[model samples]
Every structure is written in C-alpha cells, then in structure tokens.
Target chain A: MLTIKNLHASIGGKEILKGIDLSIPAGQVHAIMGPNGSGKSTLSYILSDRAGYDVTEGSVTFKGRDLLSLNTEERAAAGVFLAMQYPVEIPGVSNMVFLKTALNAIRASRGQSPLDAMQTLKLLRGKASAIGLSEDMLKRAVNVGFSGGEKKRNEILQMAVLEPSLCILDETDSGLDIDALKIVADGVNALRSPERSMLVITHYQRLLDYIKPDAVHVLAYGKIRRSGGAELAHELEEKGYTDFVNEAA
Target chain B: MTLAAFITRSRREQEDWKYTDLEALLASTNKTFNLDTGFRRYDEDGDNRAYLLFLNGVWQSARSRFGSVPSCILMGDLESGYQLTLGEQTCLVAQPIEMVFETDSNAPAEIALKLSIDIGKNGRLTLLENHLPSNTITTIETDITLQSRAKFVHGKILASGTHLALHEVRVASGGYYNNFSLLRGGHPARNEINVTLEGEEAQAALNGIMLLRGSDHADTTTRITHQAPNCASRQVYKTVLDGKARGVFQGKITVAPHAQKSDGYQMSRALLLSDQAEMDARPELEIYADDVKCSHGSAIGALDEDAMFYLRARGLNETQARALLIESFVAETLDNVQVEAWRDIFRREIGEWAQ
Candidate 1:
C-alpha cells in the first residue's frame, strides 16, 4: 500500500505538484492521465527520490514507513520501483550486471542472500524472454544504442526481475509501438497479485485497454481532478483533456 | 649506503655529467633504494643499437650493452627507407633504429636519457622499453625521422618502483606512430609523451592505463600534432585512483593548416574510490585544418551510485560493489592491449591494488 498526503513538489524553485493527495491499496492498479505540464511525472519522480525534485511540503508513507526519509536506493530496496520516462543510458554497463546489482540490493535489504552469477543469469534469461527481449540485449551496455521499444521492454524486464511491491510506470506507453505496448502490459499483468499494487502513468487510453486499471485519476496542474473507474479513461479518450484544462485553469 | 654516497661516488667515477639539479634531488633524499637485479638479460643480435643504463638517474655507461653499429637500409622512398626488426617480424618503423635503457640501483634517484631515430623510405621500426626499477625516476627524449610510409610502434611497461618518469617523442613526415605505456607502481610518477605527425597519411594511437593507490601519483600527458593532410590520431586513457592517491591525464590533439581530412579523438576517464583520492583529466583539441574531425572529452566522477546500489541490492556489500565497478573501469583500457600475458599481469596488479 502507498499513500501520498497533500504532496507539494517543485524543481528549480518552480512549483509543480501543488498539494496533491492520493492513496492506493494492495491488489489494485491505478492509471494517472494528464496533459503536458500537469505534474504527472513530477509525482512519480518525487516518490522515487530522484534528484532535482524538491518536496516542498509532503508526507509519503509506503507500507507504513516514512518514504521521504529514504534515499533513492533505499526507496528501491523498500519495494518502490519507478520506470523512468527516459531511462538513463549507462555506457559500458551490461544490462545483466545492472539488473543483478539492483535485485541483490533489494534482496539484501530483506535479509536474503544475493543470487550468484549462474542463478542471476538463469533468473534474468527467463524474465527477459517473457518480456520479448533477446539474450543479446542483456549482454550489451544498459540502454546504450537501444531503440525506444527495446528500452521500454528493458524497463519491464527490470520490474519483473526486481519484483517490487509497488511499481510506478511513468509514461510507459510513450514511443512504444502496439506490439511493444502489449509486451509491457503483459509484463505488468503477470506481476499482478493480491499483495502487489501498480500505478500506471500514461496520457492515452490505449494502454488502459491492455492493463485495465481498477481506478483512473485525471491529474491537472499538480492535483488529481477526477477519480473514477475504467470508464473515465474511455470518456477522456473521446472528449480529450480540453474540459479538464479549462476547468483547472 | 645512502643515496647521497652512491650518487657522489658515481659522479666522481663515471664523469657522465648533465643535470646537477637532478643529482641534488637525489642527494637530498639520501635514501638507499634497493632493487633485485639478476633478471634474465634481454638478447640483442648484431645490429647498430644504442644501449644506456641509469641508476637513480645517473647513467651507468660502464654496465650498459650495445650491438654493432646500425646500418641504413636503402628503399625506394627516402621517407620510408629503414627497417628495424625485433626478430624476423617488422617491429614498428616510423623511426629507424632502436634504443634500450635499463637501471639497477639502490638509491631513490631519477634518470633521464635521449635518443635520435632516422627512418628511410618505406621503412618501419619498433621500440620496446621495459622499466623495472627500485624507487627511481626515469625520463627519456626521443627524436624520430620518417620517410614515406614509415610506421612505428613504441611499447613500454613500467612494472615496478619508478617514482617519477617522463617520455618525450617527436615524429616526422609520412610516418605513423603508436605508443602504449602501462604503469603499475611507485609513490609518485608521470609519463609525458609528445608526438608531432609531420607528414601526410601519418597516424598515431596513444593508449594507456594507470592503476594507483597508497599515496601514489601517476600523471600521463600526450600532445599529438596533425601536421599534414590525411593524418589521424586517437588517445584513450583510464585511471583508477584509490586511497589517498592522485591520477592526472592531459591530452591535446592539434591539426595544422593544409592537414585536410585529419581526424582526432581523445577520451579520458577516471574512477575515484575514497573521498581523499583525486583524479584530474583534461582533454583538448585544437584544429586549424578546415576539413577535419576533432573531439575530446574528459570525465571524472566517483563510481556510479546507481550501479553501486544495483550491485548492493543483488547481495553484494558496499565494498564488493565498489570493487567490481573499479575493476570494470580499469579493465576497459586493458581490452586494447594485444598480449594476453601482459593483460593478465595488468589484471593481477589491478586486482591487488583494488583490494
């Protein structure tokens, strides 16, 4: 379970997420749709403890612990996963190595032994194939020279391997083709369970068609304007964000 | 015996005087530097060669070895006329002739030497220098002449206790020069290399890696010139600075006028371990040639936090994660080294240094 209470965030002294409150319980999927400059990405970044984002006034409690006190890596170890909109390209770092490190960090935090090389390879291979990535991609440097679809698939592969309690997919549908979208959606769907939760952040209803969310929220100017079921996504797709934009203004 | 006594005796006996300031530095240190000699001596065939030896920067000409006088090899092109062989294989011939320097000393001192090389038309040569000293300084100056199509490769390895060092090299027209320097030890050291590609179709590659710890200082500076058309040059240097050690890398590539189609690339990267450790990298490119591609980049940072966390999350402690990342950074440079045995040695040294 993740809870954000009256969260206010900004970057470079400019206010972005202005007093937003949201809560999601276990076993539910939530989709946050918003137009550009609506602070949708800012909320995800703040939760992930990314740099350059100042939490002016907010309290984020994940699994009953104060999430704001933890660093980025600590947040990840506490089962907070953020699929960044633009995944960083780290040259000379292999994807397998990167994933193994992340997974082991999380596992160690839970008092589990780190997987050995063979165990890591076996574990990564299965998840990679499930997410439609070839073994060659794992050997290459992380996100270096990767295509848009391949980068998204890599993110999903990471999510699958890490198996976080709460996954935040920030703009997971951006620049992905329909096939890549289905693969990403399937990755999310496979991880769905009674003990896990997901916040699927997107601007279009197309992604909602694949991974149906239990709840949908329209974010405008740093606050959730409306909350409804899957029907809200369909209505927004048909009506566009013009009404929400005017209302928020 | 102290270094002061050793230098005084050598100066009085040998009489090969040049730099008194270096001698004064040696006298001030007054430390008895000991080295295990009696390693297998390198073989030399009957050829014109210059053999030099320095103990704590004092030339030990008495113990040095030289071959028969070098003979000029006549070829079709004057610019490329000489061939220097390390056996039957053409070693590397941008400059003709070979010079070798060795030291066996017991004092913390510095050594500096110079050599001039001339290559004829279509000639090629290779110079291989190996330094295994005990607490000494080594400096070398080399001037090279290359005729058309002359090629040279200078391979050097500093395997042990050389406190400080510098190597300056100059290249002439229609020549290709490649230099590879590997540093393994010493408290504070430097390898300075300068190359001028004075001819068309001249190419150069300067690649090096320095792994240091324990208050060590390793500095590598290279200045490459593109003097003629179609000249190309590349430099890649990587350093691992741990403990309270420091590593410095300064590389500059210059393309002169009428050197059209000249291409140059320079990259320097460093990985810092402790807060006390330091790494400085400066890569510069200056071009006067209108038609050329020149770029330089320098990066200095601690190990990637994400990568480190990723490693830790997998099961490794913070120490293991840092070690793996440092090894990866230093091993990248060894990937280009040709010999597997040498690479193995480098890896072994790096592994020990990382720990």
Candidate 2:
C-alpha cells in the first residue's frame, strides 16, 4: 500500500534520511528499528508531509498516487496517519470537539455529509469505550494535562475514528510502562486487518512483542541496513544495535 | 465641564488620555440631528427579566416581569438617563437583564450617557449591556457601588462605531464584582475601568475580549485599587487584531499601605492574525503594602504556527484551522460567563466575527 524509493530528506540544510527505501504492501505490518538519529521519525514525517522537511530526492507512492505532491491535510484525507511522538497539547479545543472536527473534515473531503453532534458523540463514545477512555477525558482539552499513556491511547483512538489506510506509529512505546505498553499494543493489535498497512518505528523491541510485525528492518546511519522476519527484533535486543552501527559506519 | 472641554483639557493637560483623539468626534457633533428617533427594535428571547432601552443616551422604554414594577429598578426617562438601583438584601437569581444603547444616525455625532447603579447590602444582580451604533461617537459614563456582601455581574457587548466608555466601581466588605466586555471592532473604541476595593475581603474580576479588523483601533485602560485589607482582584484581557487593526491595553493595580494581604493578578494577551496588525500592552503594579501579592503580565504574539500545523494535520483546511485556534484563544474569557445563554450569545458573536 506504500512505497518509498531513494528517500533523501533534510531539515535546515542537513540531511536526515539518506537514500532510504522501504515498502509495505496491503495487509502487512512492517517495523523499523534504529538507534538515535537514524532517521526513523524523519521518514514518518516525510510521509505525512510535515513542513520544514525538505525532501531533496524521494518518491513516496501511496495507493499508486504520488504522496509528496499532496499537502499535510491532503495526505491525511488520503488515508495516511502519523501518530506523533509527542502529541501537541491544545488548550481550549476539547478532545471531543477536535475529534468531531477532524472526522467531519475527512468525511467532507470524501464528499460525505458531516455528522451531527449526537452522531459524532455516539461514534466517539464507542471508539473511546473500546480503548477505555472516559467521557471526562474526552471532554477536556485535546491532550492537555494528559498522561503519556493517555496520549498514546488518544492517538490510537483517532486512528480508529479516521480509519486510515496506512498508519505510522512513531515511538509509541517510548514512555509507556509495561501495562501501558500492553494496552497500546493490544489496541494496535485489534486494529490490524487486511487491506490496512502499518509502519511501526521504534528504538526497542518491547512494542514488537505485542504487535507482531510481518517484516522488520534495521535502519542505521540514515538508511535501512537489514530486512528480515520478526526474529530480527530479538537479535537486535540481544546484541544491541552495535553490529548495525558498525555496519553503517 | 462640558464633555468636549474635558476631553480637550485632558488631551492637552494630562498624559493619561494620550491614545484617544476625540477631535474629529467633537468636531462632527456641531450639526445636531433630530432626536425623534426612538429606541431601535431588538430581538428578545423572552427569557430575560427586564429590557431597558435607550435611544441616543435617553431612556426610551423599560420592560420588566409581569406585575413587577420596572420603576423599582430603573429610574428616569427620555429627559435624562436612567439610574438602576437594586433593593436591599434582594437576590434575583437566574434573571437576565439587558440594557440597549443604540443610535439612529449614520453620520458622526456625539452622544453622552450616564448610569448609576446601587446594589444594597447583600443584593445580587446580573446585567447585560449592548452597544449598537453606526457611524457615531457614544460616550457612556457608569458608576456602580456594591454594598456589604453584595454581588454584581455586568456583561457588555460592543458591536460597531466609536465608543468612549468609563466605568467606576466600588466594592464593600465581602462583596463581589465582575465586569466582562466583548469588543467587536470596526471604529475606534476605548474603555476605561476604575475599580476600588473599599472594604475588607472584597473580590473583583475584570475581563475583556477585543476582535478587530479593517483598520479598527481598540484600547482598554484599567486601574484597580486595593484600599482595604485582604482584598483580591483579577484581570484577564485578550485582543485579536486582523487586517491592519491595532489594539492597546494599559492596566494598573495599586495596593495601599493598610491593604496588607491583598492579592492582585493582571494579564493582557493579544493575537495578531496579520503581519500588518499591531498590539501594544502595558501592565503595571504599584504596591505600598509589603505583604501584598501583586503580579502582572502582558504578551503580544502571532498565532502559534505549530498549533496551526497540528490542526491542519488533522485534515482541517487552513482557514478552518486558523479560525479554530483563534476561537480557542478567546474561549478563555468567554467561558467565565455563568449564564449559559450569555455564554452562547458571546460564542455566537465570536463565531460570526471569525467568519
């Protein structure tokens, strides 16, 4: 469902993702494990079309359409979702209001009528219940004063509500405890299905324990150095990215 | 002294009125228009307790609840302005009263209005003031005094035209006073607020929001005095200027020597939506009491670009994203309204202004 060829990206005149290539077909889940500054998050940002990231040489194709040509909102409406490493705390905009606006915006882009308040609330309640989010949490400002686990769960809830075709999880397990990790992993597991693709970017193998990936790639020094099965995560966990670092060097 | 003479002397003699130039307004009032135009029609939701209408600074009509004497609260008629005096120890809960000040001329004219409100001991009242003028200069002078343990809430909306408003407030022991203003700007407007905490343990809050566009200029000047021991005051003012509009906020809080344990906080924030728009803010605190706690802050900034990007990444268009953030910025002031309908009214006004 997604393809990247020779992806060379930079920010403020310094290259981050250098000659990187990856592909995830429909119904498959791929994982990218890398050390610090390996361009893992940069790849996700490039896919979502965030500003300030200059894609010098890259071709990202989503569902046979050139993804780089679309703006951030266009990419979102075209079913590309990026779960940010740190969710922005927006005061004054309630989570429910934000979700409703986002859902309606996506729906409008697809030529669908907007949902009323009641319908929107009902949909949000169902999705929130599945992820154990309370009505009070949904009524507060979006991610304002939320715990780390709650933010990740909210991201997942948004993913469920938008029902995107491709999902990019950027460091979803970074600050989570064991329990939060399992809960988040369970939420991701429940959302996995045919015709949907996921690119899980992480620095550790802890999250891969719950949300098993069909393929794993080691990204070091701004490029993918190895591609293998899920066992590669175990190997990296045992050896620590030392071998991968040396290979890149 | 005459209004024009007072303005001229203040402009020439004092630095307090530096930003307001009333020369044009005073010059245009030389031609008198017919005063036959009565009160302008207003759409009432029928949920309000009373409607006090004024046409060009004169009382036109006063409507109250059935069998309740409107004269008990509103005094005077077209010959003079009205004085609102609440009865002693009375609580009129959940009752919304509206006061309308509207003009009938499109030409630049000057009109003066005076209002005096007295809240008896332990009394409570809610007031909504609406200013609707088209191409006219209106000066409103109001004095409000709250007796011991009394409470008063004043909500105001300014839609169009030039407004020179002055408010003087006195709070007695254990009394509470709240004043909120939403300024939807087009012409030059200035609001001056002076609050005096006279008795022990009194509380006061002053809040304002200004939305400006099209070269409109709005200024807010406030001075709060803590005259008694243990008094507290809070001030939160926000301004949003777009399309070359300019906004200014000047506020000061003073704590007297005997006003020990007094607490005062003041914050003024502005959001500039256009590169050409400008905002000026000055928050000052003067304290003679060593034990008093006084804090003041002022911030002028453009919209948060990261916030804009966050909203857009959620699939909102650029305009929609900006409007949402702007609405959120003003919601901090609007959310303090205790009455649901009043809050809705302010929200609807902001929604329309955003569009």
Candidate 3:
C-alpha cells in the first residue's frame, strides 16, 4: 500500500534522512523503531508533504501514485493520514466541526455527496463512543487545553472517522499513559482490515505491545539497518539500539 | 474647520490617529446623493417584539410594529432623533428589540442618524440593529444612559460603507453596559466609543469584530473614564484584513484621582491575511489613582503556518483552511457577546464573509 525508495530528505539544507528504503503491503502493519534523530519523523512528514522539507533525492509512492508530487491536501485526499506527535491546538474550531469538515472534504474529493449535520453528528458519535470521548469534548475547540491522552485519542478518533487507506502513526505512543495507550491501540485495532495498512512509528516497544506490528525495522542515523518480525521490538527493548547504531556505522 | 479637518491638523498626530487619515477620508467623500426614502416595513409573524424600521433617517410607522409594542418603552420621535426609555421593573427578556435601517435607493450619499437610550434603575434591555450595505458616507451618533442597577446590551451589525459610529455612554452605580459591533468592512469606516463610569461599582464591556478585504478600511477608537471607586471596564476587539485592506484600533482609558480600586483591561488582536494587508493598534492609559488596576494588550499577525498545515493535512484545501483559521481567530471576540442567540447572527455573517 505504501513504498519509500532511496528516501533522502532534509530541512533548511541540512540532510536528516539519508538514502533509505521501506515498504508495507496492504493489510500489514509495520513498526519503525529508532532513537532520536533517526529521520523517523522526517519520513512521516515527507509522506504527508509538509512544507519546509526539501526532498533532496529519492521517491515515495502510495498505491502506485507518486506521493512526492502531491501537496498536503491532495495527499490527504489520497488517504495518507499522519497521526502527529503534537497535534496542533486550534482555538475556536470545535473538534466536531473540524472532523466533519475533514470528512466532507475527503468525501467531496472522491465525488461523494456531503453529509448533512445530523448524519455527520451520528457518524461521529458512533466512532467517538468507541474511544470513550465525551460529547462535551467534541464540542470544545480542537485540542485546546486537552490532556496528552485526550489529544492522542482525538487523533485516533480522526483516523477512525476519516478511515484513510494508509495510516502513519508518528510517535503516537509518546506522552501516553498505559490506559491511554490501550485506548488508542484499541481504536487502531478496531480499524485493522485486509484493505488497510499502518506504519507504527515509536521509540519503545510498549506501544507495540497493544498494537502489535507484523514487522519491525530498526532505523538509525537516517537509515534502516534491520528488518524482522514482532519479536524484533522485544529484542530492541532489551538490547537497545547499540547493535543497530553500529550496523548503521 | 470641520471636525475631521481639525483632527487632520492635530499637533499630537504622531501619538494618536497616525495610522488613519480621517481628513483625507472625509475629503475623498464629499458628494451626497438623496435616498428619497420614508418610514419602514417589516414582517411580524414569529417575532413578538416591536420592529422599528428607518429609511434614510425617517421613521416608517406604516410598516413598523405598533400593536404589540409596549407604549412605556418608546419616548416618541424627537429632534435629537429617536429615544427609548426603560423604567424599573421592565424587561425585554422574551426577545431582543430589532431595528432595521436601509436606504431607499442605491446611491452614494451621506446619512446621519441619532438615538438616545435611557434605562431606569434596575431595568434590563437588549437592543439589536441591522444595516444593509449602502456604499455611501453614513454616520450615526448614539447616547446611552444607565441608571443604578440597570443592565443594557447593545449589539450592532454594519455593512460595507464609509460608515462612522460615535457612541457616548454613562453608567451609574451597580449598572452594566455592554457594546458589541460586527462590521463587514468599509471604504474607510470608523467607530468612536466614549464611556464614563459615573458612580461606584459600575462596569462596562466593549467588544467588536471587523472583517475586511480588497482595499477596505476600518478603525475602532475608544475612550473610557472611571469617575468613582470600584468601577471596571473591559475591551476586546478583533479584526481580519486581507488583500490591501487596513484596520486600526485606538483604546484610551483614564482613572480619576477619586476613582480608587478601579479595574480596566483592553485586548486587541488582528489578523493580516496577506502581506499587503496592514493593522495598527494604539493603547493609551492615564491613571491618577494609585489603587487602580489598568492593562491593555494588542496583537497583530498572519495565520499560523503550522496551523495551516495541520488543517490541510486533515483534508481541507487552502481556502477552507484559511477561512476556518480566520473564523477561529475572531471567535474569541464573538464568544464575548452577552446574548447567546446573537452569537449565531455574527457567526452566519462571518460565514458569508468567508465565502
């Protein structure tokens, strides 16, 4: 469902992502484990086409389409979802309204009729109930004064409501308690289907415990040095990234 | 010399009124066209309160609400324009009184209106005014008086025009006065508010929102005075400018020597949607009392790029994201509207402006 080939990206003329390659087929979940500054966040941002990032070289493809050429909104319409580590706190725009607007925009891009207010609320309620999000929270401004757990749950709620084809979880496990981790993981688990794919990006294996991945890749110094099964996460937690760091060298 | 001209040659031009060239504005608009309009017309199917309509400063009694209107509230037409006096035990809680004004013809002309409102002790009232877009030089002067323990809420919606609104207000002890204006740009429009807290324990709130684009111009100037002890006032104004449009805000506060324990706060924020857009803010505070507390804040900025990217990544296009963020910025001021239902009116207008 997603492919990154020889991915070399940088910001402000400083190279962060060295030449790298990774792939996740449909129906499978892949986890990228790396220490700080491994270009893990860079890869996720490049996939979503955030500004200020210069793609020095390499190409990224999503479902046979050249993802590098698509802008942020276009990539969103194409079902590229990135659960940001720090979701932007937007004042005045209610969480419910933002979700509805996003849902309708993606739907409109696909030539689907927009849902009315009632239908939109109903659909949001169905998805929100699963995450234990209250109606009041949805009515509040997007992520304004939200706790870390609440913000992550809000991201998962968006992922569930938008139902993007390829979900990129960029450090979704950071700042989450054990309970929040389980809730977010449950939200992700419920959406796992044969037609959907996920790339779980994390620094620890605890997140992988709930949303277990089909494969694990060790990323360090802007390159992926190892790829193995779920057991690789447990191994990294125990042995640390020392071996992976040496391999990159 | 005209008032606008005298201000044009002020010696203190550098300190205040530097950004807005009102003299040139009034000079730019001298020709006036006659509207040739008369009394008002309105439908009263669902609304129970009196509907007062005015065309080109003339009251239209034929089309306005009469049978349902309470006789005790209206003070009849006067040489100083219209008047409303609410005595004690009076309350318009059922619905806000609606006043509509329009021009008879589509002609650029100078229209002046005057209104005076007096609330007796402990009286409560909410007044709403709506003006249609008349591309002309229009001006209105309002005088407000609040008695002890009285509460008065004034909300206004203005359309595009060279509109100038001058408001003079006074609040007695235990009285509260709220003024909110939502302006839809202008060809150099301005609002000047003068408020005086006369007795102890008086309060006032002044808030407004301005949306401009395509070379439109707007200005909000205010002066507040605390005459007695334990008085307070607050001001919140937000403006959004796009294209080459410009917005200005000047807020001044004064605490008299005898006015101890006074509290005054002012917050002004503006959003420049494009590099060509501009916003100017000036806050002035003069304190004679040592026990008074007064502060003012102003902020002008463009839309947050990070917020923009976040919205787009969620599937909104550039236009949608920009509009949403702008709406959010102004919502801070909109939330301060005392009447909850009136908030929807502002929201609907904001949505239309966005479109």
Return the top candidate by TM-score: 3
Q: Least accurate stretch of 10 residues (summed lDDT) in model 2 chain A?
A: A42-51
Residue by residue across B17-136, what tens digits does model 3's lDDT show?
Answer: 577777676566543323333212223245455667776656667756744457445555524578888878677756687777777664335666778888999999888887766655
Q: Output the number of the DockQ-best candidate.
A: 3
Query: Distance (Å) between predicted and true CA of A237, model 2?
Result: 1.5
lDDT of 2 by residue, B62-160 (tens): 423322434456786533656888878887655667777766754336677778889999999888898864556677778899999999998999886
Per-residue C-alpha lDDT of model 3 across residues A60-95, encoded as one tens digit per residue = 889999999999999999999999999999999999
Candidate 1: tens digits of C-alpha lDDT, residues B1-355: 2334434644784422221223543334433334554233232434333444444444444545533423332112212222222322233333322233455534435544444556556656656566654555554544566555666666676654534444444455556677777776444455667777777777788888787776566668788888888888888888877787777787878888888999898989887777898777777788887999888888878887766544443334566567667767765666765545446545665655555
Each prediction's TM-score against the native?
Answer: 0.68, 0.92, 0.93
Clashes of 1: 36
- Model 2 has a DockQ score of 0.61
Off by over 4 Å in 1: A246-249, B1-85, B90-162, B168-177, B182-188, B196-202, B209-218, B225-231, B238-355
| Model 3 ranges off by over 4 Å | B1-16, B27-50, B66-68, B71-80, B106-108
TM-score of chain A of each: 0.98, 0.99, 0.98
Which pairs clash (backbone N, Cα, C closer than 3 Å) in model 3? Answer: B39-B60, B40-B60
Using DockQ as the yardstick, the better of models 1 and 3 is 3
